[model samples]
Target chain A: MTADRPLRAGAGLKPEHHRHILESRPDIGWFEVHAENYMGAGGPPHFFLERARALYPISLHGVGLSIGSAGGMTPGHLARLKKVADRYDPFVVSEHLAWSTHEGVFLNDLLPLPYTEATLALVSRHVEEAQTVLGRPILIENPSTYLRFEGEEMAETDFLRALARRSGCGLLLDLNNVVVSAVNRSFDPLTYLDTFPVEHVGEVHLAGHAVLGDIEAPLLVDTHDRPVSPEVWGLYHRLITRLGPLPTLVEWDSNVPAWPILEAEVARADSVLRAAGEGRARAA
Target chain B: MLPLDATQQTFAHALLRPELQVPVAVAEMVGPTRERRFAVHRNNVKASLVATLAAKFPVIQRLVGEDFFEATALVFVERHPPRSPVLAEYGAAFPSFLGTFEPAVDLPYLVDVARLEWARHEAFHAADAASSSIGSLAALADDDLESVRLTLHPAATVVASAWPIVSIWTTNTLDAEVRRIGPDTPGEIALITRPDEEVFVHLLPQDADRLIAALADGAPLGEAAASVPDGFDLSTGLALLFSAGAVSGLLEGMSE
Candidate 1:
């Protein structure tokens, strides 16, 4: 198996900047790609990804396994995801701590999972099942949401902590998601950062978001289309300060800009890494 | 014990139903109003699916206009939701759905355009293959030339539409069309393939039926040629197809 760069600070490899990434060979710790996007048999996305893989440590972040669903997991989705993970051999395979598919119909969004013991137990089992199937310790990412469950019995952070403990998996702390969810829910973001079992964190994700509506009841959607917000970056600096350097990816999915702009995001993340010390890969 | 199945079912309901209050039994997340919280997810599911369709059928969206197209897509989502998580392969039957859709019936070419778009999508993601060049067959005996089975490219798609779908597709997607963009023919055959990892479109009616039929039958090159028109130049056809990375499997069939 190929070992990725030991340092952290990464970003989602945008298609728009494929040529620029290839031509300039910008310095980013590593690159993460949504597994579904590269699932196509043969295309520029896969073609360029192959080229980038040789130069960088790759992480395959999945958006679709429907891990938190009540209708059990989709075998087809798992099979497909396994096929990709085998082919790419990503250093880290991660998925959202949310459900998207129900009754065989895919919603295509990360549907929230309640922070109750039952939900936790179900999700933990699913995570372990997924990790065992994928033949690796997959990182489960906490999702950003605008909704709260009425009967949720636990905080999301605690449930995630329990999930990692039970599943023998790791955590991919999306700082922007934390900030977005915290701001949206009117919770203390620092407690989540401070209280989260930092030892379980294996990777980090930094991405741009859309500020929807008013700032008070503002739903900061994890759109991944704009520049990472100052607040979110501030959150990342906080994460680097505490969680220490981890493989962080700049995610820009929609309205993708030119390669240089994306590369700049990479550079910015690299700057954080330098400040945080080159220890993102300091053995999770 | 937390009822895992029941919580998930309730979660699904809460996500899809805009007005449905969170089931009293479900777990609490980090938010005040369950509706406001679920609203983000509702928007996400709808928006992502819509965007996936938009990405797949750019020309169709352009033809129908944004508002009408989005409405059509939302309707499609309600009627025939995606069965797969892979968005690329999600709308395989969307073109067929468009044909039966009442509002889209007026624009008969819309279905064909969708078909062509889907074909392109298939070509983009299909498997890679080392194309068997015409040279590989040049050594074949005269008998094998007509009866031997030929392989089609993994990325190749045979789309037979009654409307000038290929022209319409190219007019919108290919930037810089010298020809006037007008609905012309009732039928067109599009050969979509990704030879150099770049998706390309080829207009092929003369070679479509014989090819699709031969590939479907796995007929040897010689036998497959006999099935085509008498004047069909095997060399020229094979060369055009082979060079374009359309010939995928070309093993000689076991002699019967």
Candidate 2:
């Protein structure tokens, strides 16, 4: 078994910059790739991923596992994910708390689920199943919500805490999601984070959000384009200062900037991570 | 209050069908109205899939204007939502869908163009394998040539079209200039291969696909070469196949 390597901060791997990354060998913490993007049998994705794996620690973040599906998880997808996980042997493997599949169709978007006892039970069962198939404890991320359900019987943080405890899985705290959900749902972001089960967090994600609608009441969309916002950066500071450093990833999925621009984001995140680590060291 | 199963089924149904009302369970949030808020998920489901299709079929999008392509893609997305979570495999049915799309019917060759594009995509992601060279075939004894069955690389595929799709795909892709393809333009066969990890689209000679099809069917070299009509340019075909590294191996000991 490979020993777990430490990852401070990393950038999402983009196909356009794969060759550049291999050639330049940029000084970043690690690289995280969407598990779905590398699910292909063989090609440039695998070719570059293999080379990158040799250079840096890798993390597999899944976007379509649909672990919260009410209809239950697909065994085929779980098997395919296991194949990828075994082949890459990434330091961390994480998936969203949202479900993207309904009936038989994949919606290609992380649809939110109600925070209820039944929902928690379903997600925990699926998460356990995935963990068994993957042969490892996976991290479930807090989703970015646009609307709430009246059927919700519990708080989002309660649901996540219960999920992690029950399934023995870690949590991937996406700070941008916190800000987006807070703004959309009329809640304080910091208050929500205070109640979060930080001890269970294995990784962190920071990204930029798009603000839609009017200034009086803005709707934040988790569009991972552009750089991380100051608000999310502040939240990351709050989390890292308290939680110490984790494997933080700066995600820019669409409108992916050039390598230098993306590298700057990774660099900034690395600096924040280093400062937090030093602060924790001094306190100890 | 709706249960988890009912809530998901209702939300999912409303997400795909915009005409349907947002499920009653989705309460009014702080910022936007429930309809406006739920529209976010609606927009995300269709827009993201549309974006995936657009990325996969850029040449098709280029052929039809962006608006037309998006309109047609939205229809295709609704009609054939992806069955798998891998978005890369989402648009396998798009070529056939375009064939019947009334708005794109005027561009008769669009379907073939989409096919060539899809072939390139499949070749880009197909299983990686070592390719055989012409020397491998030459090394064999002349007596063994009849029994030698050439195996195409896993990434190799032949797309034969009645329209000049190769030129259409090329001009639109490499050169920014869009040339009008006349109805009288000659048909072409495109051979897509990713031999050394880079996908290349080559215009093959007429009826080259038949040789590829025969070889792909595990036919022996001599029989596959003979399957073509007179003046099949067997030497050139063999050279092209080997040079592109499309021939992965040569098999023998097969009974005819």
Q: Whole-model lDDT for model 1 versus the true structure? A: 0.78
Each candidate: RMSD: 3.3, 1.4
Per-candidate TM-scores read: 0.91, 0.98
- Cα lDDT of model 2 by residue, A144-177, tens digit: 9998999679999999999988999999999999
User: Per-residue lDDT of A116-194 in model 1, one digit per residue for the tens?
Assistant: 7877777888888898788888888988867665566888888988888998988888888998888777788888888
Which residues of candidate 2, in runs, are more than 4 Å off?
A1-7
Best by lDDT: 2
DockQ-derived CAPRI band for the predicted complex in model 1: medium
Best candidate according to TM-score: 2
lDDT of 1 by residue, B1-256 (tens): 3465666676666655556786665335443355555567777877777888888999999989999889888878767778777788888888988989898888877887898898888888888876777787777787656556677878877777777777888878776854575554557777777876688887774655575667657776656667778777766766777676787765664665
What lDDT does the true structure give each of the candidates?
A: 0.78, 0.89
Once model 1 is optimally superposed onto the true structure by TM-score, how far is the C-alpha of residue B9 displaced, in angstroms?
Answer: 3.0
Evaluate candidate 2 and give its CAPRI docking class based on DockQ: high
